[model samples]
Target chain A: MDISGADLVRAAAFIGAGIAMGLGAIGPGVGEGFVGGKACEAIGRNPDEAGLLTRTMLVAQAVAESTGIYSLVVALLLIFVV
Target chain B: MDMVFDTVSIVKAGQFLGAGISIGFGAIGAAFGEGLVGGFANCSIGRRIGMASPYTRTMLIGQAVAETSGIFALMVSVLLVFGDFSANGVCAWTATLSAGICMGLGALGSGVGAGYPALEAIWGAARQPAVGGQMTTTMLIGQAVCQTPAIFSLVIAFMLMFRNCVGLDVWPYGASLLGAGIAMGFGAIGSGWGGGQAGGAACEGAARQPHLRGPLTTLMLVGQAVAQTPAIFALLVAIMLISIGPTEGTILTSAAVLGAGISVGFGAIGSGMGNGITAEGACNAISRESSTTKDMLTFMLVGQAVGQTPVIFSLVVALMLMFITFNIPATLVGFCALLAAGISMGLGAIGSGWGNGATGAAACKAVAMEPTQRPVILTLMLVGQAVAQTPAIFALLVAFILMFGNYTGPVTLPAAMALLAAGISMGFGAIGPGIGNGITAAAACEAVGNRPEERGLYMRTMLVAQAVAQSTAIYALVIAFVLIFVV
Candidate 1:
């Protein structure tokens, strides 16, 4: 019982893509933690600033989220496009 | 059997590897980043438990944004795990490595970098509640800048995966693909860390000294620009490796190809971190001593230059390995040697860079307080940095032996293990010396910065302590030598 050359490659690429995404998530995870930590402190100190702090946190978090997004795009390309 | 294998299986393995890397590492950065933000937000919720509803809405919005990237990674992982491959065999396998590495290391910087400013901004809001708008704007802008490295990584991943762009023959193409990923991934680590350091420092600095915000921002940008060097260097290497055709020869060259990636990738980490930490130190100094800004900048730049040395060494190793045509017999020993080259250089550079970073950080702080002690600071810095460089040298020695050793006998796993052991011995082993030397140098710098009159005492203590610290690295080197030659 044996498999072809092509099948071996298929298996590797699939594994590789998963690895890429998992690794990619590392960036966003750490970045979000920084944001979340700061947001809490802001509310604790001055609840009145909550409105402004919340808005700021959201915007900054979005920007932080970009790397993860980029990873996704790459992972997708690996899966379907590559 | 003509060495025929289930080629299909190999390709499938590559895909699975890529898929795991993309989602796994990608999800990591975002989660941590979200945690940083959420933890801070929780503090707000704790105080304003009555206003929890509105706070929760805001928190969700921020969280949702952070989660978007995770979702994207998840989607991609699902596709890779289940999708049909348009290509197979070598191409697919290469793509997998490329794609996986592209995102794994790439995401490292952005997540960390973004988190720094986000953390700073939240803290800034707490301190000067009125300035929430200003801090938020700064955080967003700064975080956006950090995203550049990750984007570059994504583009390369696309090229490697979708375009099937690794053009050389299987051997070299495999080398380049792997190199490209390593180049981007490890390259980003230092830069992201540096960017975060600079941006975060500036945020805190600006908060404390609103009058000097402009200068602080400029310094942060400058520091970040310097941090980008390793990533840029990595990108160039990756592209060059990709474009070059495969060399026709023994497996030695193929090993060189793989070695090229590891050498540069690991090498860049040190320089990036070194430069960034120094830059942050300088920024910190500036907050304390605004009048010494000019001198501080000079010290910072000089420290950066010094810190980047190990990366240059790595570049040399990569270039030499890449362009040279070694003629070792195609044996397992030769293969082990090739792999050893990378591990030795890469890991060696890691310690050196980190050591330099410690030195650079101390140098900046010293120069800020005691500008007059510049001579002593510079001298001790160089001396300590040189000591830190010893571990890298040990790695180099091992690499040279692996490359040009006299081992034409029949290959055995034990012999090969000796070679591999030598590499690991030096690579992981050097870290102790590298870090110890840096700490030693930094401590000296602090003394000079604190009280120039006590220079002699500082020097003596620093040297003595450094010697003690260096013992571990020396032991590593001895073990490495034993593994390579005696074993």
Candidate 2:
């Protein structure tokens, strides 16, 4: 099948965007899971310290999730801007 | 929509494939690594509820560190997905794919390796809540070192995706860049794993035996450092590949590029892991046998140095692959042979690295076991390790033939397939002996540790056994050479 060069590039960009975010989410997902798990364990052990543990866990998870966010932004840009 | 019809060819396919691969592969190690750290952190928290604040804080910081590699990977993917490579033609497209492979795969090692220490630290802190600060410090330091490979990958990826590669025209040169990226990306894995293994072991040792903390830290650091050697070699090879590109695309240059990539990428894996294993072993040995710590450390270093043999051979093969310009007739089979030669050598190096690492670690433990038998154990370990390197050498020989040897007559499709098969035969064939040699080294170490006086006998026996092992690698090499002449 004869495919146009520009069309191929455009399609590649869209697919690339999807992959960028989809794959990018992986790092944050795993990273967030880690912090969440640890926080849960901490809270379980010292219920009294749950507040502090939860705070730390959330903060850590937030940071870990940041990469995913960055990826999303890139993906969006790929779809829209690029 | 209009652009799609206007465009003529599917040249951008590599870019899309590369972008997908980059993002997909890049995120994996980071996520898995985070999981490891987080799982341990949770377990540790459960054990020490009171230290939640400190442990949680540290856990967050560690996870943050682990995310860097992923971030780098993301950057490359975004660049690949968004960037304009249409004007650059095949060279640009191939480079994009290499960049994706480099960053995506490169992130795998450091992202995972860094998390290991974080994991161990969280677990260690739970057990020893008082040393949370120290744990964090140590873990971060180890993670920082482990991140080198990823960083190197990033720099190269950025260069590939952004720059025009310093005017190295033609797809063959771009193909070399591809090889360099592959080398850097895959090479980091074993080293990263090795570093994590050492760092995690250190954290555990320090927590369980506070008195041996100093020694454990030293051993862990040293091991991590040693584990990085092969990756460093891969990096060097990569850099060399990048700088020295062929002026024009040729069957020989394209093949060389493939060879260069495999030579470094696969070459680093076995040794890197083996090095980590050594460090972990040393950490364990030092904690139990602190008195012989120095002597044991010396033995570990010696073994690690020896373990680098395959990597060295790989580097040599990579260098030869790049510099030696064999003007083979332009045929698909000839092209395949070039890549096959490189891949075979690179993969074969894994066995050497694996064997060397196992031997080194076992030797370190043996040193701890029989302090007086240091000389004997060291000797036996070295001998066994040498035997283990035969397969790597065989692979290297095949690589040399593929690079330098002149094939007779016009190349045909079957001939090219035979050459590719030859390369595959050698590449896959060498892995067994490489691993087998490690087992032999470990066994020899164990024998010496158990009976230091019987070192001579063990060495002799191992040599005999190793000779048997070498035969396989030899046969593969012979087959590859035959393919070179016949195929």
lDDT of 2: 0.72
Please give the TM-score that candidate 1 achieves against the real structure. Answer: 0.78
Candidate 1's displacement at residue B50, Å, is: 11
For candidate 1, write residues B4-102 as lDDT tens digits. Answer: 645466666777887898778877766776677667667755655665564455445444444444554554456566754435445567666566767
Q: Second chain only: TM-score per model?
A: 0.90, 0.89
My TM-score estimates for the predictions, one after another, are 0.78, 0.78
Give me the displacement of residue B14 in model 1, in angstroms. Answer: 1.4
lDDT of 2 at B195: 84
The list of candidate 1 runs beyond 4 A from truth reads: A1-82, B1-9, B41-79, B86-89, B165-169, B245-248
Tell me the tens digit of each residue's lDDT in model 2 across A17-54: 43454344334433443344344334434556656765
Compose the digit string of candidate 1's lDDT tens values, residues A1-82. 1335654454344434434433444344334434533453344345556567656756765786566566555545544554
Deviation from native of the Cα of residue B471 in model 1, angstroms: 1.6
The residue-level lDDT of candidate 2 at A72 comes to 54
Question: Per-residue lDDT of B1-487 in model 2, one digit per residue for the tens?
Answer: 3655211133366677788888898899888888888888788778878777877888889898889989988888887777677565446766778888988888898888888889888887777666767777778877888888788888888777664644456467877778878988898888877888888778777776777877787778778888988888878877776676665867667777778878878888888888888888888778667888777777788888878878878887787777776666666756876787787788778877887788788788778888888777777777777777777887887777776556665544545555665666577657765775576567667667766655655565455445544544554565556555742
lDDT of each: 0.67, 0.72
